[model samples]
Target: MRETIQKVGGRLAGMVIPNIGAFIAWGLITALVIPPGWLAELGIIGAETADTLTGNLVGPMLKYLLPVLIAYTGGKMVHGHRGGVLGAIAVFGVIGGAAFELSSGAAGDPPQFLGAMVIGPLAGWVMKQIDDFLEPRTPAGFEMLYNNFSQGFAGLGLTFVGYWVIGPVMSAVATAFGNMVEGITDAGLLPLADIPIEVGKVLFLNNAINHGVLTPLGTAEVAEAGKSIYFMLESNPGPGLGLLLAYWFAGSGLAKLSAPGAAIVHFFGGIHEVYFPYVLMNPVMIVAMWAGGISADIVFVATDAGLVGPPAPGSIFAYLPLLPSGGGAAGVLIGIAVGAAASFFVGSILLRMFPVKDMKDTDADADIGDALEHIPGISTV
Candidate 1:
C-alpha cells in the first residue's frame, strides 16, 4: 500500500512541476530584483509606475498566467486533454475565486457563486470530448490541436469561459469555505499564532539568535528577503498557531512544556517545532495541525492583520508590531494575545479529532482524498 501510494503521489507531484519552477523563478526575481513591481502591472495594485519596474508585468504575468499554465501543461504531460484542460480550469477557479473576492464591483455580478466557477472546466472537458465526433480516427479527433501546445490555448480559452460561465457555478463552493473559516476562528485564531514565540525565546535560542545573529554572522551572503527557503516555508505564522491556542485558552494538554514550547518556538524563535511527530505518536495531532493551520491563515488574511516586524525567522519579536497598536507600547503584545487564544481554540478541537501515527502507516489513505488523491498539497496547488 505504501509503495503504491508513493508511486501515485510522485506522479501527481510531477504534473505540477511548472508551477513549482515558476515559484522558484519568482523567488529569485523578488530577491535579486524588486518585489511589488510585478503585481501592480496586472492591476493587482494601483501603482501607475509599475511598467518601468519589474512590478508591473513580472508579478501580474506570473500570478495570472503561471498558475494556469502550470496546471494545463502539467495536466497535459500526465493526463492528456481532459486532465490538462479541466485541471487548468480548476486552478483558475481557486485562485480567481480569491481574487474575485479581493476585487469587487465588476459587471454587476455577485461575489460567491460556486456553479459560476465549476463550468469552466466542464466546458473545457466538453470541448475535449467533442473531438470524438469531430476526429474519432485521429488522436482525440484532431492531430493538429493535440500535437500543438493545446495546454495554453485551451487553458486561456477556458479562462475566458471561467469568467463568464464557470465563476458562478463555483461561487457557492468558495463562499462556503470562506464562511466556514470565519465561523471557526472568530477572534481566537490571532492569539493562537502567538504560542510559537514563547517556546523559541526560552527553549530554542530564538530567531534573533538564528536569523539575526547566526544566519547573518555565519553566511557571507546578505540572505535576500522573501526568496530563501527559510523565508518561504517557515516565514508565515502557520506552524504553531494551533497548539499555542490550545495551551493558553483551552489548556488542551496544557503542560508547561507544551505551552512554553509553543511560546519559545513561535514567539521568539519562529521555528517550526511542529511537534506532529511526537503528537502523532497518538494520532489526533495530524488533524489538529491541518485544521488549525487553515483557520489561522484564513483569519490572519481576512482580518487584514499581518506581521510588520522582520519575518527573517518569524518570531514574536518580528511579528508583533503589525497588529493594531492601541495601547502604544503593548500593541504587538495585544495582537499576540488575541492570535494565541484563537489558535488554541481551533487546535484543541482539531487535535482531538484527527489523530494519526508517527510511523509510516501511509498518509495516502488520509491525505489523498483531500482534493486529488495523489498530488502534493504544495506542489500541485
Candidate 2:
C-alpha cells in the first residue's frame, strides 16, 4: 500500500512539475486583477483591467487550459503523445460536465482539477489498451491510420462520459471534501489536521495533497467564503523556504552550492518540488517542515484568516493577490513569517546534527528530480 501510494503520488507530481510555467502565468494574472496591488497603488489601474484580464485570460486558463495541461501531462506520462491528446479530450468532457452544478449557493463554476487527474490517466490507460489490442492484428504500413482513428473515436467517447458523468460526479466529490474540511474548521480541529498533512507531503504526497484535496476544497470554499486557508495550509513555501535558507548558510560541499538555487525556485518560482530533493536528502528535514506546518496552521486558526482565492503555485508572490483584506491579510502574513522563522530555527538545528560533507552519489544534484530523466521532453527542460 505504501509503495502504491508513493508511485501514484510520484506520477501526479510528475504531471504538475512540468507545467510550473502555467501556474506562474495564472499567478501573475490573478495578482494583476486584485484590488490595492502595485498596479492600483501606482495608479495604473483601470476600471476594466481586472475584468478584461480575468474574463479573457485568467478564468479560462484556470478553468480550461490548466485541466488540459494536466491531462496532457498525465496522458503523456502513461503512453506518450497519443495518450496525451486523448487525455485532454477526456478532460474536456469533465470540464463540460461541470458546467451545471447540482448544488445551489456555490460561488461560481466548480474547478475541474480533480476531474483532470481522473480522466487524464483513464484516457491514457484506455489508449494504451487499444494499442495493445491493435498492435497484434494490424497489417503492415497502415498502422498510423488504424491507431489514429481507434484512439480518436475512443477519445470522443470518453469526452461524452466525462461531460455527462465523471465531471459532475467529481464536482460533488470535490464539494464533499470541502464540506469535510469546513466541518473540521467549524469544530476547531483544522490545526490538528496539519500534522498528518505535513507528514504526507514530505513523504512525496505533496501533489496529491495539493491538487487532489486542497485545491478542490479551496475552490468550493471560494464560491461562498470568498477565500479559504485550505489552499494555503499545505501549499505555503515557508517551510521549504526556511529549510533551504538554513542549508544555504550552514551546509558544506555541493549542498551549499545548490541550496541557494533551490531556495530561489522554491520560494519565488512557487514550485515546491525543487525543495523535495532537499528534504529527501535529509529525512530529518521532514520534522522541520512539520513544525513549520503546525505553527502556520495555529496562526491561521487564531487569526481566522484565509485567502481571497486559492494561490496558484503557492509562492509568496502568488499568495499576495489572494491575501484577504484587513485582518485576514495581516494574519496570513504573520503566519507565514512565524512559520518561516520556526522552520529556519528548527531546520538549522537539524543541519547541525547532520553536518553536510562531500556530496554522495545522488547528492551532487541534490535538488533535482531523478524521475524527470524517464519522462519525454523533460530532459530538454
Candidate 3:
C-alpha cells in the first residue's frame, strides 16, 4: 500500500504540467470557487430563478470548457496531433459531459447516456489506432501526415461524430452538475451569510499560475489575460470547503505547511507553492497538498467567499492595485505572515523526519529524452 501510494504520488506530481493542472482546475470548479453566479439565484427563481440559471451557465463554462481544453492540449502534446485531437474529444466527452449532466439535471440540451460517454471513448480509441498505424515507419523518424487524405478523413470523421453528435450531450451533463449545487443551495443546506468568505476563497474561475504572480505585464490589457475564465477562477474561489476537507484528512503532511508565509500563499494568495516542490520530491507530500486544497475548498464554499475582481495574489505588496483595498489588503498581509510562519515550522519538522535526498543525474544516457522514461506515458506504447 505504501509503495502504491508512493508511485501514485510520484505520477500525480509528474503529471502536473498537463493533467494535474486540469485536475486542480476541475477541483476548483467542483468546489464552486468558480461557479456561475446565477446558479445560486436560479434556485430561488421561484425565489430568484434568474440568478440561479445564470450561475449554472457559468459553472459549465469554467468546469467543462476550460479544463477540457487544458487536458486536451496537454494530452495532444504528449501523444501528437492524433493524441491531441482524441485527448480533446475524450476530455470533452467524460469531464465536460459529466459537468453538463451534473449542472443541468433535467432533460436539457444534450441527452447524456447516449452520447459523450459513448462517443467520446469511441473517438479516442479510433484516434489512438490511427496514431498507432502512423507510427514512425522509418528507422529514424515520422514523416508529416498533414497532406495524407486518408488520415485526414479518418480524423475528421471522428471529429464529426464527436462535435455534432456528442457535443450537446456533454454540455447537458455539465449543466446538470450545476443543477445539483443549486439544489443544495435551495434546500438551505448552504447559508447566505457565509457566502462572502466562502465564495471569496475558491474564485472558481481563477487559475493557479495567475494566483502565483506570473501574469505578464500588459497581458491583461492586450489579451484580457487576467479576465480569462481560468484567471477569474484564480481570483475568485468556488466553495472549496469539501475539497479542503478531503485534502486535510488525506494530505495532512502537505496541509501542515499552511504556516505563516506558506499558508498565506495557498490561502489568501492562492499561490500553492508552499507544498509544490515538497510534494514533487517526496510524493507523499501530495497527500498534504491535496488535503489542504480540499479543506480550503470546503471552507471557501461555507464562507461564501465567492467574490469577483482581480484577486491580486494575496500579499500586502500585491494588494496595492485592488479595489476597497484596505481591509482585504490587511487581511492578505496577516494571512501571509501567519501562513508562511506556520508552513516553515511544519516543513522544518518534516524535513527532519524524512530527509529528501538531493536529485542526481543517474541516467545512463544524458540526453533529456532519456529522462522522459522516468515519467509515465511519455509514449503511449
Question: How high is the lDDT of residue 290 in model 3?
Answer: 31
- Candidate 2 residue spans exceeding 4 A from truth: 34-37, 99-104, 188-190, 193-237, 240-266, 269-291, 300-334, 341-381
Q: Cα lDDT of all candidates, in order?
A: 0.39, 0.70, 0.36
- Please identify model 3 stretches exceeding 4 Å from their true place: 2-283, 286-318, 323-329, 351-381
lDDT of 3: 0.36
Per-prediction count of colliding residue pairs?
61, 2, 114
**Candidate 2 residue lDDT tens string, 1-381:** 533443454455556656656765675665666443446546687746755766787678878888899899878767889899999889989988763222323333555766787788888899999999988899999998998889889988999999889977765655554444445554668776666566555443444445555667777887887878888888888878888888887776555666776677678867675666556556567788878878988898788778876665668987887787655888888888878888888989988986643433333332124434443443322
Ranking according to lDDT, highest score first:
2, 1, 3
TM-score preference between candidates 1 and 2, better one: 2
Q: Which model scores highest in TM-score?
A: 2
Score candidate 2 by TM-score against the native: 0.67
TM-score of each: 0.40, 0.67, 0.39
TM-score of 3: 0.39
lDDT of 2 at 109: 51
